[model samples]
Target chain A: MKVKVGMMSFAHLHADSYAHCLLNNPRAEFVGIADHDLRRAQQKAEQHGVQAFDSYESLLASDVQAVIICSENVKHAPLAQMAAAAGKHILCEKPLMTRLEDGQAMLTAARGAGVQLFTAFPCRFSPAFQQLRAMVQAGEIGELLAMRGTNRGVNPGGWFNDPELAGGGAMMDHTVHVADLMRLLTGQEIVEVYAETNNLMYHGNFDDVAMLTLTFEQGIFATLDSSWSRPRTFPTWGDVTLTVYGTRGVIEMDMFAQYLRHYDDRAGRIRQVFWGDNIDALMIDEFLRAVAGEPATTLATGEDGYKAAAVAIAGYESIRRGEPVKV
Target chain B: MPYFSGNGLSDTCPRRAGNLSSVVNLLTEDAMVKVGIVGLGTMGRQHAEAYRQMPDVQLSVVYDRHMDRAEAFAQEFGATVAHDLSEFLKGCEIVDICTPTYRHTEYALAAIQAGKAVVCEKPLARTLQECEQIVEAVHRHNALLMPAHVLRFFPEYRTAHQLVKAGALGTVAAVRMRRGGDFPRTKSDWYADFEKSGGIIMDLIIHDLDWVRWTLGEVERVYAKSLTFRHLEHLDYTLVTLRLRSGTIAHIEGTWCDPGGFRVSFEICGDAGMLEYDSQQMVALRVARRAEAGQAGGVEVPESPAVENPYYRELRHFIDCYRAGQSPEITVEDGMEAVRLTLAAIESARTGKVVKF
Candidate 1:
């Protein structure tokens, strides 16, 4: 028996990618999709040959045993709680919640209802990142001293720039990825953070970019520069590079370095394509595989999402008040 | 493909912003000309060392408000220590002044009144009134005055400038330059004083803004935002946006919180292809595809700093102008114009409106 999966909305940009993954994965069946935007929902549903529902209540009442909630960041927590209550496993996207209290309640509900919960942060599965982690563990990089990582991009406006809907601007949008990657790669909780956020390019109400630095519990220092203001001419897939200076040797990689092949053979020449497409689907496939008792490492645990949220939100507070904020 | 001049210029003509060559051919004197340095601070000493490197340049005198600083530079360079402004200019044909902005008017007038050539450090004067005063003095004396705009001497920046000029890329459409560094545990300290640094735009982005203007043409209008974003007891960062008279737009970022030491990058976009270069990267020159091939790495950036510093090249250029009757890489007008645009940028940032030149 295959696991049945349904998506909550076409409102979130990555939703269609998740739906395609579920339908395409032999181990999972595409149950249905629901969204306020019927045109978008219909477009995605028809493209993937899946059922489309007009309302969340109908989608939630479906026979699927699991749900992937790829909604506006603010909807992540509430939607996760609803899915957990419906006796369905949940795959919520990062920024588990903008507010800590909501995130705590979602975790509490997941535990009380005995439902598994995960957040979508697929950076951990990158082969290069995994290689970096193994090298650190093996003492190949002895006593990690410092690290710098940048995940910058042009603004993906819509809900992303809306502080209320996206939780916050660059601080909320980007710091979580680095904070989680920090905990994932270094195994140290952030002890303190001092940050400054800038609205250098996009200025009316939102800060389209932010530069943040943190001190981790284990005495390592790291800097993460995040932005939604990278020039549009930069490769759309974006660049996330990590440079770790260790006791033995310094290791650095343009994470997209491995993406040096042609995806379209008919084209005259190989074009530049950075990210592995279908990441949303790929992460979903791994989560479904884990639930089926297949071999799998932990997907971004709700705890991972919670911590990333705490630190990301704290960084926002620090920028607002102009001081360090504890996580 | 940009028709890059082997000389490192784009299709643009000479006597403009954003052009330089990497392979160094320093000024050598057929006949040595006497030179004097008016300040003995870090920048002043760099000026002296630069002069000493030129075979045709002779350090005639050294003077600083502080006698000790002046005497030290004089002894190191085998130059006489000048007791007063008149004595310094009497012996030297050219005067290099690196004094604070307020003092520029005092000594620059003295040098020009004595009919000596002059090179002053940037922010040529404390205010527009002072800049105008210096300009009047230069015109009054028919005195040659060059401001030390050393960024023009940076090889990579020179290439970007020339690439735009030579028209391999057509009219330059846009430019981006970034200059930043970690919060210096040590700064000039006086840098924190509002009157001295002229905030971020004048102190830092002035260099990049001048580079932008050099690459494109003159800026017709400017908009800027500034803030003390970090905890260094100063205005730590500023970003300036420029609209050139030629319809090019430029963005310059200047900050003191790189948090990892200095980082510098410059990029220019044109209709046919774009050129981008960074000091942090292995490849400095990137061009669009040419007739038969894709854009090639036009030049290789050394991982290490150039064996000869840019300041050295700038001083050599000055010496060539003074002794060999050669034109400087960055002439006096370039310096004055950079200062002019810098003051306009500061005004725009302060008033929160577009400032026109």
Candidate 2:
């Protein structure tokens, strides 16, 4: 039987993409969506041709075997806990939760309830990244020495700009993706983080530009530019680029560069029409497979999410203390 | 003209007996400014080539502690060799010092003390103290000195600077610059000695550091990481994050680990738009040759032809400033500041902490 999956909320911008993935994945049954704001839920549900539940609790009470927690950064913990309590597997968003204690609590709830808690890090499913990982594993680039990554994007000015809801700013929102990728590629944990954050673009309280230097456990170092520095008129959202330097060779990967550049005078801007694999759908397929009792080796677990988020959390602390902090 | 010292021809001038005619020709070219080059290394050779291309600048004299190397260079460039430091100083009105990091302060101080305009290679000196010494000598003697921060002369970087100055990208938010290549193979491999060259952060990323300070404003703080401490053989890499006083964050990466050859790239993002340039993407020609059966392969060199070489432009600009008796765009103070910033970055990398200016 197909694994039945629902979405907990439409509060995140990725909720629409996840909803579309669920509807299109052949091995999963797309269930309804639930949100605190019924109108927003209803709008997304109707647009995706799915049912809209009035509340998250009602959605957890349904027959869905799993639920993707697509709520705001601050609400990920509670939603995942509720889903875990209802015996449903959970696929929480990028940051498993904003706070360390909340992430630990969510992991504990899932483990005690015997349900899987996967973190949504779709960049792991990128084909280019997959090839990069395989090559690195195969010793294409010999003993890894250093790495540089960037996940810069245009500012998504909504609840993301609200520090309380988003937990932090560009450092919090964008650091996790590349952080997770680094973990997956190196199989090492980030031990220390030094960061510089500024909001020069918008001059707001939330930072729109962040630069981080991360030190790994084995003495390897990497620098990450996790900034919302792309302008509104940029061709695409931004870029996910990683250049890994090893003893033997160097590999550069631009995850979303397989696109046609389209300049439209009507829209008064240039746009990138992507022709790459559906990374979100690939992630959802892995989630469903894990839900169906198959091994999902590539899926980002709750611990991976916590570790990546810890890097960003320590980044903020480093910025506060004006020094490098241990992660 | 007091610094000219009569076409620099003296009894000590080491012009070969067979090359007397060339020496006479060099002395008779009164319209040409006599230029002397010190150190026969890669940068020294590049400066000689640039001076050779300038019709109004005569490659008058050459000097190196190794007399054989200086003799060979002087013969090829149609110039006389100077065996003595004081005689070399007297031979040319402009002294281009392209020695290693440790010797920059020595030559620059000597040239400035002699009242000759000086064009010294980047990293004006090895340390802040040395850079300050050169700056002080320039002030004490009222001498003209220009640090050869050649990135300011590259057309691509110049365009980016101009665009930002013209507000093409409104309210710059961030900048990223990268430069790297294989470990340099020099005559002495002095670049491998961190004490002498200060690793990649000092010798390499100082280019971007100066460019960023020029385009952005003063740096408030810096955090950096590098493999210089690892003591790896023939490899070094560093990444530095700078917080500009104008609130812009700049990340600069410098590497000596890339085996695929040299690459330079930068991205500037602002409120209005973004500008990106990658040297690998701007290749106009590439040549690849197959390796012999038992030999390792040769590296494919990609060439991007420019209207004028940046080194030529930099030397030309310095010469023009010397002729006009005006301070150069890159003053001795600016070069000292670049050294200060680079030293700060090196400190941050070693201490693993944020260094505030």
TM-score of chain B of each: 0.80, 0.89
**What tens-digit string does per-residue lDDT give for candidate 2 at A1-327?**
999988888888998898888888889888898889999889988999988998888888889999998888999998888899999999999877778999999999999999999999999999999999999999998999999999999999999999999999999999999999999999999999999888878888899999999999998899999999988888999889999999888998999999999999999988999999999999999999999999998999999999999899999999899889899
Question: A1-327 in candidate 1: lDDT tens per residue?
Answer: 799888887667677667767777899988888877788778878888888888777888988888888788888877888888888888887778989998999999899889888888877777777788899889985667666666766677788888878888877887777678878889999876655555544553776556565667865666676656455444444567776655555566566675555655675444466555545566787889866767658479898999988887887776675555678
Model 2: residues >4 Å from true position, as ranges? B1-28, B285-304
Model 2 clash pairs are none
Residue-pair clash count for candidate 1:
18
Deviation (Å) of A208 in candidate 2? 0.7
Q: Evaluate candidate 2 and give its CAPRI docking class based on DockQ.
A: medium
| Candidate that would win on DockQ | 2
The whole-model C-alpha lDDT of candidate 1 against the native structure comes to: 0.70
lDDT of each: 0.70, 0.88
